[model samples]
Target: MTPETSETTQAPEGHAPSHRADGRRFRWNKVPEITVYFWVIKVLCTTVGETAADLLNEKLGMGLTGVSLLMSALLVAVLVAQFRTRAYRPGVYWLAVALISVVGTLISDNLTDNLGVPLETSTIVFAIGLAVVFAAWYRTERTLSIHHVDTRRRETFYWLAVLFTFALGTAAGDLVAERLDLGYWISAGLFALAIAAVAVAHFALGLNAVWTFWIAYILTRPLGASMGDYLSQPTADGGLGLGTVVTSVLFLAVILGLVIFLAVTRRDVIEQDRITPQVAR
Candidate 1:
C-alpha cells in the first residue's frame, strides 16, 4: 500500500509512526528545502495573491467581505490537502502559500476597512500575534527552524507562523506605503533594501538563522504586495496600468510553470533523513 493508505490505516489505531527513532522522526509533512526556485516562486505566489485578491474584489464586484470569504474557503481546502500529504508536494505547498497570502491580506484589509482599525494598530496587532506564535512554537519544540519541522505540532506551528507573517507583512507594508506615503514603487524599493540587509546580516554578520528566516519571510509579503500594486493599479495611482487581472494572470502563469517544474524534478521535496535529529541514547 502507498504511504497515504498506510497512514490512514495506522491513524485509526493511533499507531502510525510518522517519525523514526530520531527526535526528528515524527509524523509531519516537512517544509520544503530552501532553494533559488523556492524564493522565486514564493515571490510570484505573493504577487499573484495580491493581484488576485484585488481582481476578485474589484472586477468581480465581490466586495471585500465577499472576496475574503471566497479566498478563506479556498485557503481551507488547500491547507487540508497540504496537511494530508505525507511528504512535501511543491504544488500543494505553493498553493497553500498563495491562498494564505490572500487570506492574510484580507484579514488586514478587513480590520482596516470594516473595523476601522488604523494601519498602525493593525501592524502592532499582527506583530504581537506573530511574536506569540513564535513564543509558543519555541516553547513547545525547543527550536523554530523550518528545517526541523517534522511533526504534526511543529507543522501546525509552521503554518500558523506563516499565516501571521503574511498578515503582519501586509499591515507593515501598507503602513509604510499609505500612512507614511512612500508610494508603491518606493515602498517596494524600501522592502527590497530591507531584505537585502537581512541577507547580509545572516550570511556575513552571523545573525541567528531562525531570526533571519522569519525576517526575510515577513519582508517578502510586503515586497510582493508592493510590486503587485505597482503593476496592477491605474496609471493615475502611479502604477503601470496593467490592472489586477493582467498582473495576476502574469504571476499565476509563472507560479504554475515553476510548480510544475518542481513537481517533475522533486527538487523541493523534503527528504525524511534531513529532518531526523540525532538524539542522545
Candidate 2:
C-alpha cells in the first residue's frame, strides 16, 4: 500500500498534556509509547487474537454472527474503560487492543464467510475505509501522528484507524495464504520480509516515521495471522499442528509477562515535547 503524503499539523489550541500516574508530566496519548516491547507485544496480541477468535468460534459453537456480536460487545466495554482513562494505562489500552484485534478479525470473517464477500473485495474496502478515516482525521486535526493524540477526536480517529487495519490485515492475509494458496509459512515469510524492508527504508533511507510506523503497524496483523496459522493449523494444512489453544495460550502468556514488566517500570511513557505544539499549528 502507498503511504499518503500530507503536511503535519497539531490539534487545536487549548489542549494540554496530561500527567502520569506517578505525577510526572507526559503527553496525553491514549496509546502506549512505541518501543521494541510495544511492537513485540503488538505482534503477540495479533497472534492470540487470531487463534483465540478461532477457538471461541469453534468451541462455543457460535456461528460467525454470534461470535461477532459477543466480541463487539466486549470490545465496547473495554474501550469504555480505555476512553475513561486520561493517560496510557497499559492494561486498559492493551486489553482494548486485544479485544479490537478479535473483533476486527470477526468483522472480516463475517464479511467473507457469512456475507460471502470476497477476500480481495474486503481488503480493498477496508483499505479505502482506512484512507478515508485518515483523511478526515488529518483534515480535522492536521496530524496523524499518535504523539499528538491529546484530544478525544484524535483518539477516536486512532482507534478507528486501528480497527480498519486489523480488518484489512485479516482480509489481506487470507487473500494471500488461503485464496492465493501460498500456504502459511510462505505467507509469514513474505510479510516478514516486507516488514523488514519497511524498517530498512525508515532507518537507512530516511522515510517518514509516521508513515513507516502506520505501514508497519498494518503489516504486523497479517504477519501475526500467518504465524498463528502456521503454528496452529494441522500438518495436512501446511502447519505445525500446535493447535489453536496452545498457540493462543503461549502468545497470551508472553504478552502478559511483557505488559507486566512495562507496567512496573513505566519505561514506555512518552515524554512531552516542547516543539510538538508548533508542528500541530
Candidate 3:
C-alpha cells in the first residue's frame, strides 16, 4: 500500500480525522466506524463467507461455476442498494460485505479447483491485484483512509480493495493450511498472531494507521476462514464436525442480530461534519 501522506496524519484507531489538512471535512462517510463491533462483524462475515460457499456448493449441486455466478449476482444487487443510499445503513452495508465475502471465496476457489492455479500463484496474483487497486485509489484520491469514504468514487475503490483482500486471504490461507500441512487450527492461530502483531506495531511501534488497518483487514479473512474450517470440518479431518450448514447458520444468525442492533442503536454511525448548506454545496 502507498504511504499515507503527511497531510493525512493518523486519527485514533477506528476514527478518522474529520477535517483534512485543507480544513475541509468530507461529506458523511458511508462506512461504519472501525469499532470493536466492526471487527467482530467483519470476522463473522468472513467465516460465513467460507462455510456458506461450501454449503451452497454442496447443496445447490450447481458446481462452483454456477454458485459463483449466483453469489456474484446477489452481491451486485446488494451493492446497488448500498450505493443508492446516501449514508451508512448497517443492513445494506453488511449485507454487501457478507455477499462479497462469499463471492470472493468463490473467485479463489474457481481459480484453484477449476483452472488448476497453484495456491502460491493465486496468493501472489491476488496480492498484486490488491496492491494495484490501492495504488490506483491512492493516486486518484490522494488518500486511502476509510474515514474519507464519503464519495461514491472512494466507496467504489474501497469495495474493490475489499474483494481482493478476501480473495488473497483465501488463497494465502489455503497455501499455509492445506499446502504446507499446517492444519486449520494452527493456521488460524498463526493469522491471529499476525493480526496481534499488526496491532502492536500500530499502537506501540507507531506504524502508519492506514497501513496497519489494511493489513489487519486482509489477515482477518484467512483467520476467519481457518476458524470456519476448524469448526465445520469432520472430526477425522481435525475439526469439530459441526458441519458447514450449522456453522454458516450460526454465524449468519449472529451477523443478523448484530446488524439489527447496530441499525436500531446507531452506535457505529459516523456522523457527518456539521457543514452549512452553502459550504456543503
Using lDDT as the measure, the top candidate is 3
Q: For every model in order, what is the number of clashing pairs?
A: 2, 2, 0
Residue pairs with backbone overlap in model 2: 9-280, 10-280
| Model 2 root mean square deviation, Cα atoms | 6.5
Could you give candidate 1's per-residue lDDT for residues 161-280 as a string of tens digits?
A: 999999999899888887678888888899999999999999999999889988999999999999999999989989999999889989998899999998888787655445655221
The whole-model C-alpha lDDT of candidate 3 against the native structure comes to 0.87
- Candidate 1 Cα outliers beyond 4 Å, as residue runs: 1-29, 275-281
TM-score of each: 0.88, 0.88, 0.88
Any runs in candidate 3 off by more than 4 Å, and if so which? 1-26, 274-281
Q: What is the TM-score of candidate 3?
A: 0.88
| Candidate 2 ranges with C-alpha deviation above 4 Å | 1-27, 273-275, 278-281
lDDT of 2 by residue, 144-177 (tens): 9888775566789999999999999899888887
Tell me the lDDT of candidate 1: 0.81
Model 2 residue 197 lDDT score: 99
**TM-score between model 2 and native:** 0.88
Please write out the lDDT profile of model 3 over residues 90-181, one tens digit for every residue: 99999999999999999999999999999999999999999999999987887888876866678899999999999998898888887678
